[model samples]
Target: MKIRDKILSGILLVLIGVLLGMILMFFRQGTFSFDLAEVKVTEVNRSESPIWTDDELEKIDDRFVFKTIAKTVTPSVVYIETLINARDRREMSPGEEEDGGNFWDRYLPRTRTVGSGVIITADGYILTNNHVIESAVRDGINVTLDDKRTFDARVVGRDPSTDLAVLKIDAENLQNAVIGNSDRLEVGEWVLAIGNPFRLRSTVTAGIVSALSREVQIIDDLRRIESFIQTDAAINRGNSGGALVNTSGELIGINTAIATQTGSYQGYGFAVPSNLALKIARDIIEFGEVKRGLLGVTIESVTASTARRAGLNEISGVLIIDTVEDGAAAKAGVQSSDIILKVNGVAVSESNQLQEKVAMFRPDDQVTLTIWRDREELETDVVLEEMQPIVQETQTIPENNFDEEQLGPEPEMWEEIPGDENSGIEQQSFRELGFSIRALATPEDPDRFNLYLHRVQRGSEAWNRGLREGGEITEINGNRVHTLDEVEKEITDSLKNHRSLTFKIRTGQGTDGYYQLF
Candidate 1:
C-alpha cells in the first residue's frame, strides 16, 4: 500500500510542472491566430525596427539633404541694429524744465526711436529702410553677426522715395549672402526670410512667393513708388531690410512691408526686388543719393467703374491723369486724360507700373512711351532729365507789434497786453525765411544743439550791419553770452547803460561779425 501512495505523489508533481510551462509559453507570444490566419507580431521589442520600407528610406534621405543646406547658410547671414531719434511732441506747462522760460518762451524736448537694419556687404555696407532714419536722428547704428560680434555703423545714404537706406561698418572678414536676380524669380518659388523681428536677433522663416509686381501706397500721395515681391513669409515692424533668400541661399529681395489690417503679419509679405535694390544701392553708394528718371505724369489705374463712365473699350491699363509742367512727359507732349497702354512693349496695367518703368532709367536714358489719346494709339520718345537737388523752404514770420504768448505760450511778460489788436509774434514765414530751423530742447539735445535767434529785419539796424538771423552773437557791449540767460543779461546791461549793444557774432563756418542792437 505504501509503494502505491509514493507513485501517486510523483505523478501529481509532474502534472503541476507541465501547467507552469504552458503559462510561461503563453506570455512569450510570437504568433497569434486571428480567426484562423496567423499574425506574426514577432514581439517587436519597441526599440528595434523589425521592418524597413522604400518610402521611409526616401523620406530619411530628403530630411538629411535639407538639414545640410540649412546648416551651411546660417553662418553667412547676420543681423543689424539701428538707433533713430525724432521730435516727440508733448505740450507741458511752465516750470516743467530747469530753464523754465527762456528766449521769451518755455520749451519741450524731442524724443528718440530705436530700430534694426541688415548687412548686405562683407566690407561693411548695410541696407535698411528710410523710415529708420527719418528725423535728423542718425546716430548709434550697430551691426551684429550670428557669432555675437558687434560693430559700429554709419549712414552712407538714404532714399525716402523707395524707403531704403545704406549703412557702412568698419569691419573685415565678414560673410555676404549671395545676391540673385529677382527678375528671374517666379511665383510659388520657395524662399527664406531672415531678419531681426521684435528685437529677436537673427531669426529665419520660410514661405513661397505668393505674387509679383505688387503696388502699395506707402505714404499718403506725397511721394509713392511701388515695387514689391509678395511672399507668404511672416514679417513684422522690425523685419525691414531683412533678406528674402532662395532655396540655394541666394538673396532675391529685401523684406520690407506686410499687408495686415491689425498692423501685424497676416500671411502677406512684401520684399524689395533685388534687381531694383542693387541699382539703388549702387547709385546711392556712388552719388550719396538715388538719381533716377521721372516721367512727370500722375498716372492712374483704369477700374471697371472708370471704364464704364469714360466709355473705354479696354478695362485695363494705366491712365495719364495729368502731365507735370516742364517734365519729361510734358516735353514729350503727353497730356491729361490720355491713357498709357504700354512701355518698351511691357503692358502697364496700373499707375504704379509707370513709376516702376520710369525709375528703371537714369537721368539721361531715354525711353519710348505708348499712349491712347482720342482713341488712337500713339508713341513718343522722351529724353529723361536728372532730378535736381530739392531745396526745402523754411518759414519766417514778420516781427510785427507782438507779445510773447503767440510765440508759443510763454509765461514771462515784458510788456502789458494791448487788447486783441496785439496778437503776439508772427510765425516763421517759410517764403521769407529761406532756411529750415528749430529750437533745441534741454534733455533731447542739451549739448551743442543748434538754435536760431530772431532774423535780421531787412531795413533794421541789424541788417544794415550785415548781421543775419543764423548769426551767433556770443558777446554784447563787452558782456559775454553763453546760455540764453547771458543773452538776456547783456541786453539788460545795454539798456541800463543807455547805449546800443555792439554784438560780436559767429557766422557760417565760424566766420565772425559785429552788429549793434539799437
Candidate 2:
C-alpha cells in the first residue's frame, strides 16, 4: 500500500507541470499575433506614401500640357467659309436637244467651300491658304471664331505663288496666335494642329515635326514657291489654313496641305513655315501685294549625271541651266553651268531651296551667292530685281496704201463659200488652227487696220495657250502681218512644215505677249 501511494503522488506532479506549460504557450502565441498586426499596419502606411512630389507630378502630366496648349491656341484658330460662282453652262444649239433638254440652263450655281484660318493680329487679321479663297465671291466670305462670333471677312491680299492669303475682319480684341521661329524647330519636337477639319470646330490633333524644308509641288502656279514643313499630323480638306503650333502654344507653321492618296489624312501633312508665312502676311498688309525678288537664272537640282559631269564628289547644290539676258544673275556675272552652293550664307542643296531663299528678299536686296565654278569656289554679290511678267513687243504694220476692192471681194463673201470650193479649203485650213479673225478699221483713224481674234475653238492649241477672243495678232513668225490673207498664208505654211508657229499678240488691255502654236 505504501508503494502505490508514492507512484500516484508522482503522476499528480507530472499533470500540474503539463497544464502550466500549456498556459504559457497560449500567452506567447497571443503576443506574437499582436506584433504581426503592428508590422502589417506599418507596411500599409509605407505603400500609401506619395510616389511623386507636387512639382514632379505637374511636370509629368502630359494631359495638362496638351490641354493648356489647346486652350491657349484654339481661340486664335477660326473657321472660314467661301462661296465660288460656277461657270454658266453653254447654250445648246438647235438640234442639240440630245443633252436631256437642260439646254440654256442659265442659272448660275454657287459652290461652298470650308476651311480654317489663324488670327495674326489683335485688330482681326487672319492668315489662310490662297486656294481656300481663290475665286471667292466678294460678299460670300465669313469667319467664325471660337466664341461663336461670326463676321464678314475681306481679303487683304493674296499671293498665289506662295499659296497664302491675308484677310481682315471688322472686329476688335481678337485672339492672335504668337508666331514662333520655325528655324529653331527641331525634328521630333511635339506639335499641335488646330483647325476645323471636316467642319468640325475646335479640333486639335497632336504630332511631331517629321521634316523641314520639304518641297512638294502642291501649288499649280507657274512661279510656285514651296518650302514646307512636313509632319505626321492628321490634316484633312478643311484643315488647310489652320495653325500648326508648338508645345509652347506658339504658331510654327500654317497647315497648308496633306500628302495622301485618299482625300483625307494618310499620316503625312504639310505646312508653310511660320517665318515665310509671317513674311508674306506682313508684306501683304503693308504693300497690298507680295514683292518677290527674282534671281533671273533658270536653275535645276544637282543630279548624279550633272554632278559627274561637273566633277563633283557628291550630288549637291543647284545647277544653273541658263541665265536670262540683263537679269540680276547676268549682271552679277553668273553664267550657265555654275553651281550655286549657298545664298546669303545659307547652304542650298536644291533648286527650290535657292528659289525660296532668294524670294524672301526685296527687289533691291543685295545677296551674296557662293558658287562653284571650274573647281573653284567664288562669291558674287547679286542685286535682286523685280520679277516681271513676260512681255512681248507689239509689231505694228504700216497701213496698206492699196485699195480694199483690189485685195479681194467683200469680206462677207469669204464666209458664204461652199464646202467644195477653193475658198472653203482656205477657211477649213484656217479653222484647223483653232481661231477666227476679222480686220477692224477705226472710223477715227481710217488708215489704221487691226486683225482681231473673234473666236477661239474650245480645246484648241490656241485656246489652251491662253489665247482669247478680242486679242489682236501683232506679228507671226517675227513678221508683221496686216491682212488676214497674210496671216492665213503664214499659218498654213507653218502647218505644212510641221513647225511650231509663234504669234506676238496684244491683249485688250494693251499687254503685249507671245503664244506658240504647234
Tell me the whole-model lDDT of each prediction, alpha carbons only.
0.64, 0.79
Error of 2 at 328 (Å): 0.4
Model 1 per-residue lDDT tens digits across residues 60-173: 643323334445555555566544322123343455553333443323344443345555677878777776555433455666777788777778898776788888878776
Provide the clashing-pair count of each candidate structure: 11, 0
Task: Show pairs that collide, candidate 2.
Answer: none
Q: Per-prediction TM-score, please?
A: 0.57, 0.63
Please write out the lDDT profile of model 2 over residues 196-229, one tens digit for every residue. 9999998999989998878776776656788898
lDDT of 2 at 15: 97
Global fold similarity of model 2 (TM-score): 0.63
